[model samples]
Target chain A: MIWNEEYETMPRADLRALQLERLQETVERVYARVPYYRQKMEEAGVTPADIKGLDDLRRLPFTTKEDLRQNYPFGLFTVPLDRVVRVHASSGTTGKPTVVGYTKRDIRTWAELMSRTLAAAGVRRGDVVQNAYGYGLFTGGLGAHYGAENLGATVVPISGGQTKRQIQIMRDFGSTVLLSTPSYALNIADVMADLGVDPQKDLKLRVGVFGAEPWSENMREEIERRLGIKAIDIYGLSEVIGPGVAAECLEAQNGLHIFEDHFIPEIVDPTTLEPVADGEAGELVFTTITKEAFPVIRYRTKDICRLITEPCVCGRSFVRMPKITGRTDDMLIIRGVNVFPSQVEHVLMGIKGVEPHYQIVVDRQGTMDTMEVQVEVSEAVFSDEIKHLERLAQQIQRDIKDLLGVSCTVRLVEPKSIQRSEGKAKRVIDKRQL
Target chain B: MQLEQIAIFLENKAGRLAEITQILAEHGINIRAMSLADTADFGILRLIVNDTDRACQVLRDAGFTVGRTEVVVVAVPDRPGGLASVLNTLTEAELNVEYMYAFSQKSGDTGLLIFRIEDLDRARSVLQAAGHRLLSGEEVSAL
Candidate 1:
């Protein structure tokens, strides 16, 4: 089932050589085209010619989300507008989004990587692939789409949401491969049960590729049990060329195999920014070796996971990274949407008559992530009539939904109820075991 | 006549109602009549107390979100159709009642009804013109 046996099974020495050659080309290209990366490299007193070996990657400056944000839309893209074919973005810390671009060949590379990802997940030609990742400025949707199509699978470009219809289509289309965020998979299973369509009897699903949000082993078990499919964990970020960067081979299903041929993976101590020993948990950093339009060098991903140098049972020589355990920052993925506490505070601050004091309570209810924003009700917001207070709650809910694109319960409590700390107010209470 | 009623926000937790009542009891505040409007998460307790300012202050100090609202009290005959007749007059006069609660007086054969109306002045004129007996703040508190 290996999509490209030659590259996927390339020996460690050959892969390292390929990575070093691509790394030099990427470093030289960025230096000649992108002023930002060149400035960062110059600041570190390192030139493109300095990168002779894979170990010299650390000599080059590390790129971060802040670098992406400062660059904004296409500041870091090495190619001109005519060469770029597609663009995607993810939520940034503030209002503006972090953007990435891809050339035509970059798109083809993405497809090839995703094809490898799907093949690793046991997807092959003739299998009906129901892609439920959201299709928009977010990369998850179209990323999986082109990959499924490239793998020669019958692609049902059905992007996320419409849970009942998703199950209906899966049952009717004889779909074998499911692609979506893990939480949405649970949602579809729940809807299927409600519709009396037992997955084991009414559907033909065999495997699922779930990603875009961190989930637990227990969640994986629950999804597998309910959907009656082998739940494969896929890992990617918009910054790292979307969901095709890594995937869990169905043979091992233990850790996700990083497509090392396209992207170089490194685990570094988040605090010290030093490389952590192999098999040790630390922050994951990536250098897009084969990417053309937007090639990043040593981009700090902030996602905390370890690297498994041991070869996977699937015979792919790529190193595997386990499921991400935690984040270095306070970013809450509610139902697969990135939410920051400051975003909630921004919404609350815009609305008058309510104190800015708030707490975000995130808990999993029956395999779904539920967020409840608890705000302290000031005297000005309190109304003797229930309708007025209800309207206030609705306003907060609407504003948050409009801004964050996630539905959450807004609870108004007595004044001073949300605890205020001495150093920093504990703004989030994440109850999800993951 | 208009009467001052205090509304307290209550979390839907056990002993919350008792705690509010105990706070009022400790303050020696007499409760004339009360009603509770509840939802799944929280409730609003509306009370016509003997002392509106004192009750609101006590609840506010105890960390309860309290608000003062003006409600109209009407005296209705202690008969089944008497309540219906008052509502009929209100319907004819085009007055909207946000909420209402009733309690029978200790001595008289009449019931005291608290009506939360939007336009209190217009409601007062309409009820008085309809020959309905209205109770003042003092009359309701001393009841």
Candidate 2:
């Protein structure tokens, strides 16, 4: 069901008008309060007055992750420290994390949006939610926790890790809804098998909200079959309000409905930084219209997806986006062929006897680029005859070639050889740089 | 009789074989016979050890993919035509040997040949009917 009927079911014309008004106000607030945005606007030769309506949003300067990094801690905050009630940061593996702050009103707004997200996924007041997202700087754990609580649901703020304990809690607590990354959900299913718990018979999970990392449809099938739940794709990043920016409603499950009133969504050509036509895949960009402490204007998300303005069966008037195909940064160009790791993952997960744990190693062989996919096989499959193993490898190579149009060597490794990740699984290793 | 053999999955990289041998040495597990079948990227190291359980456990604990398969060990005379005679008998019986490896004992005129056949039971009965000595797991371990 659409959580907030007033805003969610607003007419298209009315939604656009509301978005235009908030967009103008956000532009003016950031221009006046944050110097970074002011300098950027001045450099682009555009003022808040220049923004006539939603149509003129293109004329303003684009905000990027680099800009947030340059501002570092508190330089991008629109309000004084006293007004900021909560803060969350991205992991930022390489350097400083992109920091975001929420005022009391902002937190309340976040809770409301998260409640909307959970409701779209069929979460109700009485459903027990066992949130498995990490709680610290990552923004996934507490973000889902607050949303479940806001929905008046029983919230288990267990966070991540301790696989055995997670399964026990899930069984004992009778959690009906689960929230975590799709990979972690699969890991939990694997652990359940080890602990002799039948997820289908023993556990009470009915719905799963999975997100944070891009996953394929094959993974969705795996999660559903193993856990006996309707695996719903929830999309969000720490940069964009954390886990509630958009979600797929259970009614359609076609595309994620962007909460347009809070965040205006845009699709843009990554290279030219110009808006792409609706229904065409491109980089996803967002502009927070109602954020009080951290307001972003035309922030490029770097995630690639298409915006579906088509009316969803769920009756939410907000624009919907399909599952993210790949991020601009995750695209690998080998032998002049663009290959996303997700495509490889789709092929690998579809095959039998192979686990989802895999690594794509790209290297320079003489003057040519070589891509090798190292996948792990189950112990039962690994113990097969040499000819059988060879056939399996050849089958993977042929499938990848047929699907992705890129020829890659497939190597079957032993079970438990590939490293298991606690958060986002690392899928690629490029040796060309070295 | 069926003899236990441990097969290990090893990446076709330098020092991988050395690592396995070193681990076996540290555990005081004597390697009676071994064979390596390899492709471009990986290899399978099939081994007959004095203590199959201990060797398999140690290697598996060290994160190696170890599997046990029952193989037939036929004792051949320590002569040039000893293996040829055994192959001739198997060829006449229409039995296929998947893989085989051999090693001679220092104190005997007999060599132990490990054969991985598609039909272990049939091959073992056929060899026994032909009066060929098929070593037991205990006999191979004692070697």
Q: Which has the greatest lDDT?
A: 1
Summarize candidate 1's per-residue lDDT along A1-434 as a digit string, tens digits: 78999999999999999999988998999999999988988999999999989999989889998899899989999999889988998888775688999999999999998999899899999999999999999899999989989989999988988888888899889999999999889888888888899889888999999999998899899999999999999999989899899999998899988999899999999999999886899999999988899988899988999998887788999999988989998888998899989889888988987778999999988768999999877777887778888888899999999888889998877677778899978999999876
The whole-model lDDT of each prediction reads 0.90, 0.85
Task: Report the CAPRI category for model 1.
Answer: acceptable
Candidate number of the best TM-score: 1
**TM-score of chain A, cand. 1:** 0.96
Candidate 2 per-residue lDDT, tens place, A222-288, comes to 8899999999998887677888999999998888999999998888999988888768899999989
- Count of clashes in candidate 2: 0
* Tens digit per residue, CA lDDT, model 2, B1-143: 55799999887778889999999999999999998888887788999999999999999888888888988999989989888877887888899988888889877799988888888888888888887888999988887
Off by over 4 Å in 2: A331-427, A430-434, B1-143
Off by over 4 Å in 1: A38-52, A190-203, A222-228, A419-423, B75-86, B129-143
Clash-forming residue pairs, model 1: none
What is the overall TM-score of model 2 with all chains considered together?
Answer: 0.61
